[model samples]
Structure formats: structure tokens, C-alpha cells
Target: MLLRTERQPSAKRSSGRDTTEKPTRGADVMGKGSVLIFEQDKIVRDVVSSTLARAGLEVHPAAELDAALQAFESGKLDAVILGAASAGDGASELIHAASRVSLEVIVLSSSPTIEEAVAFVKAGASDYLAHPARSPELLGRIERILERRRAREDLRSTRQENLKRHGVASLIGSSPAMQRVLNLVDCITDNHDATVLILGESGTGKDLIAKMIHWSGPRAEGPYMNVTCTTLRDTLLESELFGHERGAFTDAKTQKKGLVELADGGTLFLDEIGDMSLAIQSRLLRFLEERAFRRVGGQADLRVNVRVIAATNRNLEEMVARGEFREDLYFRLNVIPIVMPPLRSRKGDVPLLVRHFMNVFHRELHKPVLEIEPALMGQLEAYNWPGNVRELRNLVERAMVLSTTEVLWSVVRRRSRPEAPSEASFRLPPGGVDFDVLEKDLLSQALEAARGHQARAGELLGLNRDQVRYRMLKYGLNSPAPARGGLALRV
Candidate 1:
């Protein structure tokens, strides 16, 4: 829970409405934990800091980047809040640094452009809100982060005895992004029967992430099922997902088991769920809310204790805004969200993935991938992986096929961008060419070289007759070519 002693924003302004009448609590509502606020705006900082300090959370607000980071690393903060700044500012970078130390982060800024909001979340911020937020809203957001953090910490404690490295395609990296994801998974495993939404760009290994969650979770003893949202048509999808009673439809000759049923007491991974049709989504939403489902043409509802983990490349919030997805359903499924980072942002993990891939392909295809060329490594790092990890894996395999030697660079087709400008044509001799003198001399020489024929003169200069004439006109160079192929210009 949030430290509640802070003064709630004055309700006296808006029709004398008080936001919170609840009793005061400390930042350590769960225990004795502190909060940090980093901001340069003195007024905003003071108001927020004072409010939190009064709430009993031990709020420490820093007014500069260095000071903020110092205080961040210098203490064990339950959460970090960064106040407002304009676009192209260091706000995102500041959040990133805070992520390394704090379990939860909240950003307070003005209403941002859609791109800015996406960028903020992508940078590891747990949540963002407009600055000068009401103390009630601020406190609510704080508790969410702190509560989630404590949940994760508890989850980690439970996993300490049995938690092991990710199996097969292990997510190998100590990057802050990966650490948070791991922490989220730890939390998921502790809480049973809660729906988890795995949000990320395609090819960020959402499936692998789901498996990791289930394998380490309380449901590890149960089966795991997968349902691709894009594959089935509307009616078929519904019948298939919820199972169909005998004679439910023309093709439903016998009773069938649903993916949800198969996944009972385990985890159900729904991939590309953002594409699921509204009709099916409605049914799924009911199941999520009631913890039970009714098969096609069945009057009775069947209860299942299965964890629903969904993945999608599309922005569900945008879909909801556009009226394509249900807003209520969106909120229900987003209970515990885990956003995966793209491959381009974490270049440090590239080598680890390369080695892991090499070992897998070596045993299967009987080819050794002992070394990668430095040039190729440079190329891989330089290229923006629009397709993310899936593309990277495919490219590595393609390189292996074309490799005669253990050298891996030749298979990489992307060229390296030039490091610096060097071969431009602008630099000339100390004494630059005299435009007038050179024009006259070139006219005379080209006509002579062409034997005074206009067409031939054009050929000598590697240009068309019209092009030569146009240049001559622009340069004010007029030299007549004789019918016998000789021409000259007088000084």
C-alpha cells in the first residue's frame, strides 16, 4: 500500500470534494520502505516530496540528474518517481538508470504525445501520469507499484529454493529489462489463477516467456496449452476454444475438449490475442471474470483453474480506443503485464544469443560455429533488426549453411555503413580552377579534340550534343565548330 500520510490534493478547489477520507498510512504500509522523487522543477518537487514525507514514506527528492542517480543507488528505494520534462529531454534516460536500482518507477509529466508515452513505457517505466496529479491519484499509483514490488519480492523469496536457469532457449542477460521481466515471472508463479498479459513487439519470445513463467510457477505440475488467435475463423475459434457439445453445429458430431479445458490446472498461452474477433473475445472475457466457461450449446458452466497468458504485437489500448477491442476486457486481461524489450535495444546480449544458437545448430546440422568474424559482428550490430529475434535466428542459420570455414561473417549479407566521410569531390588544389579561363580553354580543347564537329565534340567530353551545348550556354562559352570538324574560341 502507498504511504498515505501525505496531504491529498486540495479537494477545496473542485466543488469542495475530498478525494480520500481513509486513515493515514506510511510508505512502508507493507513494511518499512522508502520512496524517492527526482525532479528539477522545485515547486513540483517540493509539493510531491512534502506530501510523501508527510504520508510517512520517507520521501527523498533530488533536483538534479547526478544527485537523483546518486540518491537512487545510495539507498534501497521501494519506488522512484520522476517529475515532468519536455520531449527530447533526459527523462527517459533517467528512468532507465533508476530501473537498475529500484523495483518500481512512476513518471509524472504533462500529457505526452502518443509516441512519447510509448517510448516512456518502452524505457521501463511502470506507469506515467500528468504532472500536478491529485494526491489521491498519486498515492494510488504509488501503492500499485509498491504492492507489485512487494509481491515480486515475495515471489522471488519463494523461488530461491527451486528456481533454476531458463531451460533450452534461456533468456541470458543481466540487462535491467530482462531483470524486471524475470521479477515479473517470479511474481506470476506465486499468484495462481491470475491472468497475465505478455505485451511486446513480435519475435520478442513471448511464447518462451510464457513457458518460463509456467515452468517456474505453482502450475508447473499442470499441462501447458497454446492457442494462436489469428489462425481460426470466428465460429470455429469459439467452438474450438470453449469446446462444442454434441450436435452443437453441423460439424460438431461429438463432444470435444477445449484448449482451456486441456490447460486446466496449468497455463494457456494465447498468442496474437489482439487479433481475436470481438465475439470470441467476449466469451473469453466472461471466462476471465467468472473463472468458468460454458461449451457451445451447453447450458452448464465448467470451472477451470488455468492461468491465461496472452501475447500480442498490436497495441490493445489503441484497439480499445478505436472501438475494435472491448475496454472492460482489456482491463481484465491486463492484471499482470510484462512487456518484452526488442533485440536492437540490447546489443550486449547479442554474443550470448549467437553462442547459444551456434551450439543448437551444430548438434542438429553437424556444422561447427566456433568463431564469428569481427566484420560480421560489426554488421550484425549495425543492422536494425526490424524482425527482431526471429529474424536474427534465421540469419544465423543461413550464415551457417553458406559457411565452408568456421568463419561466420561471410553469411551476413548486410553491409557496414561507412564510418567517416573521406572521398568527397569538393576538396581541390590550393589554386582552384579559374571558371572563366577554364571555360574558354575547355571549349577550344573539346572542339579541337572532336575535330570541330558538334556531335563529336559532345562525345569527347562524355556528354550528348545538347548537354554540351547547354553547358556552353550556361557557362557563356561560345565556340563554333567548323563543318570540317575544327573549332576554336578567341581570348
Candidate 2:
């Protein structure tokens, strides 16, 4: 009975029903919702209440603003329909009160002009409906508003869940070393603009640590951009960092913004920072000091708010001592230094890491690997992982991808080591041997263990291939051994 009943025009009584429109059922217009009606006119109030009740909504009718506010507070009202004629001077006040509690307010007017309707909307009215409106129009508007509110709530919940998964829980380790790292991260997670320096060897998950800090901080909603300093040349890297004006150079056809500008109010991660040239280091230092930078070929200085997180596997102290890295930049970037321990140092957490990766790849590959062979697991834990967590993850993925068995047993094994003798089984020579000779012997033994592959040999010795090659050249081992993949190893 939403539409007005049409029989004949009544000159004596006002029914507040539209005679031209046909009656429509409220149930077909919208779903059930809670509504509060505030109106002083008896006929108008009854009409609205009846329409809403027939529409399957929980309806509450109030004669004055005070009673309306009481009902609004008592019931879980999704919306409020106020008659401006009866609301009179307190119409705006009622609208504001409903808004404070996040309740949607709709205003009904007898003769609302365009400006009056606009004013009501500006005063926090969700919608303004003129008198003599159809019941379907009112119910549809309320349905749409409730639908949008539900959508926003659902989206917010999804974002919070994602933040929890990637921000803190992704670190994943119970070892003492990992616990210390987590404690450090937790302390500074709220400091959005603090510079964080992550120190670790390659593949030690420095990038992961940087992400954890950024995503857990206040700037989590902002942009995050990661750049590898060593991957770009000096000139290109400069333009990429500080942007460039149009006609600045041969390739500068149009003005471009840099990572700093793009990452405003968020974080900019500079990986392999030890490889950055001295010139870029000077520019970076100025930005850190002043929070401003001039684009290439541009005279204007642009200011930006950004958090700088730097990571590197190289030894910065040694580079500073050699005058290759700026000492001032080193101290500035190291405001909060977090050291990521290599995987070999935390052997006790190997099994946990293994299971974590197994679950990850199993989901990705859609394959079930429910168990691990004890022998293979023992070998994995015993091996000294040079590439750290990255290497271990790759090893697990490799085994899972290639094996067809329900239980994983195949493993990538490193060269076997000769058994070490007990302390009592060996006697020191009368004249102690030179430390250099022993070091050289160990280097040669590692080379033999790797079967003359410099890369694998370096992994065994905890050094890179370049360092191993330099050592071989110094020891006068010039004969090249046969190797695959264009690798020439000194025999």
C-alpha cells in the first residue's frame, strides 16, 4: 500500500496520498532495513511508517526531534527520514547528529527548491525527497546507500587481512637470531620517515626485511618502490632518482618524475647501495639533509617527504676506509641498522624454513608433498647454504617440481666433505705452521671439492668467484681446468 488510493478529491481532509500514482508493494522495491521517521504532521508520519513497514523495513515513528534521537540511539537504524516541515529550525541539527553516528539521513520536503535541496545535502543529508514521491523511489535510494556501505566494509576488511599476512607474519622464523631481528623491526615500525639500513650477504632476505619494515609502518598505504643501484649506470641512475626536465638531455623529450617523487609519503628502497658511485652518493646526501632536490637541468628545487631504506651485501666500512664510499652518507643512512643473519648461522630453523617453503610451493604447483625424507632433511640442514634462504627455497622448489612421489626425497647435494679428526687424534707440530699456508691449503681443498668450478668453490669457502679467481692468480695456478657454461677454473 505504498501508492495513494484514488477515488475522488477530498476538499475537507488531507490524506497526504498522491492520487495520480498507482499503489505499489514496498516488499518488491527493496530488502529489509532499519529506518527512523521523524515528523510532526500526523498524516505524513503515518504514511511514511506504513510504507516502510510494508517494504519489510523495521520502522520507528517519532513525533519530535528529541524522540527521534532517542529511537535513533536505541535501534540499529540504517537510515533516518526527517520531514523538514515539522523539523522546522532543528532540521540541520538533526541531520548533523545522525551524521556523527554514521547514520544515513534523508530529508522529506513539501516544496523543496533546487537550492534548498542542495543546502540539505551540504548539511549532511544523504538524500532529499520531495513530498508526493513514490514509495519505490525512497526504498531504492536507501537500498543503494546500504549496498555501498557494505562494499566499503568488505574492502577494508580485505586490506587489513593482507597487511597482517605480509607486514609482520611474513618474517617467519623462531630462531634467536630471527627473534632479535623481529624485535628491532617492531621497535621502529611506527617511525615512517626513519632511514633503515639493512646489512647482510646476498640472498640473506634483506629485501624481505625492508618490505616488512615498510609495510608494517604508518606509510603502509602509500607507494613502495625498490631499485637496484648496481643495475643502472651512473647517469641513468641519477635521472631515475632525481627526475629530469624536458629538453634536459638527448633522451629527455618530456619531463619525468623520479622515484623520490613517486614514493612521496611512502618508502624508497635502494638495494645494492654499496655499489652506488660517489657522485650519486653526494646527491643522495643532500636530499637526506634538506629533503629537497633539483631535477636534472632544472633550476627549481622540489621537496618531497620520503623514507629511505638502503640494503647492501658489500662491506661499507671497508669501502669507506678505501675512500670509495662517503663516510658522511654511511652514518646518515645507518640511523637504524638491522643485520639479517645468513642461513648457515641458524641451522636450527632449517626444518621450519623447509616446511614453510614446501607449503608455499605446494599451493602454487597444486601438488601435495606431505612428507620429507629424514636422510634428505639431514643433508639439507648439514649443508652450509651460501645463498642463504633464497638458495634453500630454490632447492625445495626444485625437488618438489621434479619429483612425482607423494613424499619428497630427491635433494640437491653439495660435494661431500672428508671426516674431521678428533682433537686428541692429531698432535701439533713442534714448529707451528704459517697461517697463510693453512689458508692457501683450505682454498685448494675447496677448489678440489667443487671439482674446479670457481663459483661452487667460492660458495664452499664463503667468498665470491671474483675473490676466488684473484686468490688462484696470486697462488700462480694458471692452468685452466675443463668446466661447463664457459667457466674456466684454475686447476
Query: Relative to the true structure, how large is the alpha-carbon lDDT of every model?
Result: 0.72, 0.79
Q: Can you give the lDDT of residue 215 in candidate 2? A: 77
Best by TM-score: 2
Model 1 scores worst on lDDT over the 10 consecutive residues at: 1-10
lDDT of 1: 0.72
Candidate 2 per-residue lDDT, tens place, 237-328, comes to 99999999999999999999999889898889999898899999999999999999999989999998899999998789999999999999
lDDT of 1 at 117: 58
Most accurate candidate by lDDT:
2
Per-model C-alpha RMSD: 28.6, 8.7
lDDT score for residue 345 of model 2: 89
TM-score for predicted model 2 compared with the true structure:
0.67
What is the clash count of model 2?
0
lDDT of 2 at 87: 87
